[model samples]
Target: MGVTDEVLTEEHKIEIRRYFYNHQNADGGWGLHIEGHSVMFCTVLTYVSLRLLGESSADGDGAMRNARSWIIDRGGATFIPSWGKFWLSVLGVYEWDGNNPLLPELWLLPYILPIHPGHWNSARDQCAKEDLYFPHTRVHEILSSSLHNVVEPLLKKWPLSKLRDRALTMVMDHIHHEDTSTHYLCLGPLNKVLNMICCWVENPNSKAVKCHLARIKDYLWVAEDGMKMKGYNGTQLWDTAFSVQAIVASNLPNEYGRS
Candidate 1:
């Protein structure tokens, strides 16, 4: 869903084109959401999305041209955030080294350690990961603080080593478990795309890729403007809670003498 790897069908392409065109700002760029201001993250993703949907950069309207200029003014796609870089890498539009390490082995950390993921609040863990991805010597500082990072360079140099292979096997198994447990839905669209890519890389002929592809439609939504990817399949529980609150506030039960 987040810069999906799946090839879009002609109908899917049409709907996505409508969605992008409808959402583009007067400045010929996009924001993180419909009402949000234009930012590099959103702009880059939307620009790539349009290209993926078959919009050429040479279009007469100059939408892509304007976006390219805007992105260049902001230091181009290289300035995109970690998640953006990750998606671009999967799309083969960007190099993976631009992203700080997101070693799946981090999930293998012992729970008893103070730095264990189980000990982290979501926000803290997120910040920690972002800090890990920072581009400067700060990345070195962050990596030096983690034992896993300390060994990552050594592992990379010995790609054919038994230890590295075993570690990768473990990571792949963890990924598969995550996919199976989530019913191939993943934590959200971003993770779903990453998981699908990971599975494909590990074994293109594997069932994992088939399952992820099969469920791709779950993340899409058809709106009045056109089709767009939802953050999740549905927020049924959230909507239900709001509906109940609205019903309670209307005093309909009192009017019916139910109270």
Candidate 2:
């Protein structure tokens, strides 16, 4: 976590690149999930990841070339969904200012408040058409416009800016608490990665960042295709319970089961 290139070992990087290549859609892009159709959201992110791993635009046996073509045909990374944009921005390829304000102050509100983070929708409704699950409502459009045009500018000024700083402190406190409580794995793969990023940003050499790095292997799974992040750390209790029930129903011999 201290340095970008040192995060993954050489072997780890090779397998990660293999996973992307093996899962590429016939159209030379990737899907939002495994075995799904290629979408801008997945395609652009995968392409950027390949580049970060030292693949040129021409690498991957023409796979990278075709991926670029797919993105170009769909208006490049500009149409990638907000999730992809966030990753790209963190990687320094996309402009952070291009994104709508995600007010950290929202985390400061009471849980009982309707404006609390649980229901907060700070970003605009923009996303690649392929990834759009629901159409944007008029109310959402108005809210996005208001935040982008009015609220964001005002928040940059005196008193409101101080509030943002305080809110950030509160957010980091929560993140650290969650990391220590969960032994640095957090809730799931997504939150684990997010929490790790926050820790790295806060202090790359801090104990929290080191603990997060130690727990990373918990999320990795090696399949026939390649290694990939599991949906969560593991469902050990759930899997064990079901497996025991099945073995009992089968009336497996005690010696055979024990063996």
Which has the greatest lDDT?
2
Clash-forming residue pairs, model 1? none
lDDT for each candidate structure: 0.80, 0.86
Displacement of residue 115 (Cα, Å) in model 2 is 7.6
Q: What is the lDDT of residue 248 in candidate 1?
A: 79
Clashes of 2: 0
Listed in order, each prediction's TM-score against the native is: 0.48, 0.53
Residue 198 CA error for candidate 2 (Å)?
14
For all predictions, the C-alpha RMSD in Å is 11.7, 10.7
- Native RMSD of candidate 2 (Å): 10.7
Q: What is the lDDT of residue 254 in candidate 1?
A: 61
lDDT of 1 by residue, 1-259 (tens): 4444355667888887788777878776688889778888899998887887778997527778988888998888999888899999999989877889867776799877776556543343344555666544767656654644456657666654668889889988888898999899987889899989999998899999999989888898889989978898767778878876777799665654643
What alpha-carbon RMSD in Å does predicted model 1 have with respect to the real structure? 11.7
